[model samples]
Target: MTRMSKSESRHPVRKFFLFALIAGAVVAVRNAVSDKGGSYDPNEANER
Candidate 1:
């Protein structure tokens, strides 16, 4: 059998964090779109 190289090793923790970041962004956008204003306005947030 062939041995796996160091670079070929799986990084579960790294992959998990990456997935979480993407998922969080998706959820944030979804929530923003479904909110009362129906959109996200960075300027309005900054003005608060």
Candidate 2:
């Protein structure tokens, strides 16, 4: 019973890491797209 409870407690920690990993991936993709200059020129903005 003790071991079962310990293992059950680890489940939430595993889920938290999984969620963090997914969120990090989403942020990375968003940054990459925004930096790619698809619609705006970053150099022009920097010159100002």
Candidate 3:
């Protein structure tokens, strides 16, 4: 049998945070898109 190295250890907490961040970003984008109907305009700002 081979011994495991320190770098080979898995961290569940780290994985959870990474997944949460990606999921949050996706949800935020989805909400933003849905709020403005189905079209997305890069140059159309609320200030202009």
Best by TM-score: 3
TM-score of 1: 0.53
Ranking by lDDT: 2, 1, 3
Error of 3 at 14 (Å): 0.3
**Each prediction's whole-model lDDT (CA):** 0.68, 0.76, 0.66
TM-score (all chains, Cα) for each model: 0.53, 0.56, 0.57
What are the clashing pairs of model 1? none
- Candidate 2 clash pair list: none
Cα lDDT tens digits for candidate 2, 1-48: 999889868789887888999999988886676676443557654765
Location of the lowest summed lDDT over 10 successive residues in candidate 3: 1-10
Cα error, candidate 2, residue 15 (Å): 0.2
Tens digits of lDDT, candidate 1, 1-48: 234444335656776888899999999987777564554665665565
- lDDT-wise, the better of 2 and 3 is 2
Q: Put down candidate 3 lDDT per residue, 1-48, tens digits, no spaces.
A: 133343334546766888899999998997688577644654454433
